[model samples]
Target: MRRKSLSTGDLARYCQVTPATIVNWIRAGKLDVYTTPGGQYRMELPKFIAFLEDNEFPIPEELQADRTRKILIVDDEEEILDLLVEVVEGSDANYIVRSEKNGYDALIAIGDFKPDIVSIDLNMPKMDGAELVRRLRSNPETKNAKILIVTGMIPTSDLVRKVKRIGVDSFMQKPIDIDEYAKALDKLATFKV
Candidate 1:
C-alpha cells in the first residue's frame, strides 16, 4: 500500500536539506503541507515524491518506499506514542512505524498494519495489554508477530512472569533507554510480515 504522508523531517532527509528549509518552502508557498493541531507539518507522500522527481532530486533508496518491516506502537500516553514514533521512524531501519493510543485502535490498526513487530504498553485503556496479547496470539494472522512490551507502569515480578507466559518477545521500561530500544528493534528486524 502507498504510504500516506511524510513529516517535514522525513522530506528534508530525503532531499538532503534541513527541516527548517522544508518549513521555509511551505511558508514561501513552494510546497504544500497539512499542519497538525500540534503545529507539525506533513506532506502528502505521493505529492512530495512527484515534487522531487520534477525538481530532478534523487530520491533516497529508503524514501522510495522499500520498507522491509512494519512496526505498530501501542500506548495510552500520547507523549510516549509520539516519542516512540519519532525515535523509531527517525532511525535508518526504513521500517514503517504506526502508533495508536488505545488497544481498540491498535487492534484495528494491527489488521491493516500487518506489522512484523508490535511494541506496546501494558496498561492501556479499552483493552489492556494482556488481553491484546491474547487476542494477537489467538489470531492466526498475528500469532507469529514479535511482541515487545514497553511501559512505565512499574512492573512487578508477577507482571513480568505473566507477560512472558503470554509470549511477549521482549520488555523494556519507560522512559525508554535508547540503546535498549534500538537493540530490541534490531533483534526483531530479522522477522518479516
Candidate 2:
C-alpha cells in the first residue's frame, strides 16, 4: 500500500530544492499533480516515484518503503478512544492518526485525510463500522482503503459472513494487544495488495 500523496514541500525536501522549485516544475508541466480545495498541490506517490526515476532524482527511502502512513480510528467510547489513540500514536511518530466518534464524521474526515488504513469499532452509533466499510468499498476514491475492525463485539458466524462480504482487510478484538496492532498495521501499510 502507498502512503498519502506528497506535498510540494515534502517533495522539495527530498530533492534538496525549494518548494517554489517544485511548484515551478508542476507549472512547467514537468511533473503532474492535483490541487486541493485549499489550492495546495499534491503529487501522487506512484507518479512522483515515476517522475523521480525518469528525471534521475534519488528516490528517498521514506518514499520507497515503510514511510510515514496515515491512519484513522473511530469509536464511540471516549475513554477507550483516547486510550487507543495514546497507544497507537503515542510512541510511533511514523503513524499520523485522526479519530472520530461516529461513522458520519469519520466519512467526512476520510475525504481529506485519505487514510491508508482505518481501525474502527463495529458498534459505533448511527452508521456502524459495517456500513462505513460498505460505503468506503462502494466509492471509487476509497475502494481500496484497508479496514481493520477493532471492536469489543464477539464475532458470530453470521456477523463474520456479513463483514466478509463487505471486504474487511483485518480484525482485532478490543483490549487490543499493542504488538498485534503494530504488526497488523505494518503488514497492511506496506503490503502490495
Candidate 3:
C-alpha cells in the first residue's frame, strides 16, 4: 500500500506551529522529509507520527491513524438511530459510533467522545438540532466539528437558510442511503490538508 504523506502545512497544523517552523525543522534535520519533482517537501505519515511520538508531541486527530475515527449520531427515533449505528459500525472503514435519542445526550457524548463528525436529525426532541448546532458552534472545543443534518422533516426555505447560518457541512434526507452515508463518512474521516 502506498504510504500517506503530509505537506509542511499539514505537519505545522498537527504541531501547532507555523509552516516556517516545519521548514526549519526539516533544515535542521529534526524531521525527515522528501522533495517532490516540483520541490515541494513532503513527509511520510508513518515517519511523522513516529516522530511526534518519540518527541512526546501531542498527535492531532488528523494524524491519529491508530485510533478509530469516532462518529456521533443523534435522532429522536430509536429505529433511525439503530440503523445509523448499524451502517456506520458495519462500514469498511474503522469507526467507533455512538448514538443518542436526543440532542441533549448528544452534547454529553460530544464532550466525552470528541467525535470527528456528527450526523444529527433536525427534528429531534428535547433540544432540537438547530439549538444543538448553535451550542456546538459556540464552544471552542467543538466549533470546528463537521456536522451533517439528516431529517425527514420537510424544511422550509427559511429553515434551510437558518441551518446554513449555523454552518452545517452537509445535509441528507431521512431514510438515508447507506452507500452515500458511508462515502460521506470516509471523506470526513480521511480528510487531509
TM-score of each: 0.62, 0.68, 0.67
**Model 2: residues with Cα > 4 Å off, grouped in runs:** 1-62
Q: After superposition, how far is residue 11 of candidate 2 from its true place, in Å?
A: 14
Where does model 3 exceed 4 Å of error? 1-67, 155-157
lDDT scores in order: 0.81, 0.82, 0.83
TM-score: model 2 vs. ground truth: 0.68
Count of backbone collisions in candidate 3: 0
Ranking by lDDT: 3, 2, 1
Would you give me the overall lDDT of model 3? 0.83
Model 1 lDDT per residue over 11-89, tens place: 8888889999998999998787898899999898767855774566765655554546779999988887888888898
Q: Model 1 — which ten-residue stretch has the worst lDDT? A: 59-68
Q: Over the stretch 1-193, how does candidate 2's per-residue lDDT look in tens digits?
A: 5557989998899779999999899999998999999999998887886677556677676675745677898999999788777766764547888999999999999999988788888888889888899899998767767888888877875665587788999988878887788788777776543
Question: Which structure among the candidates has the greatest lDDT?
Answer: 3
C-alpha RMSD between model 3 and the true structure = 8.3
User: Which regions of candidate 1 are displaced past 4 Å?
Assistant: 1-67, 191-193
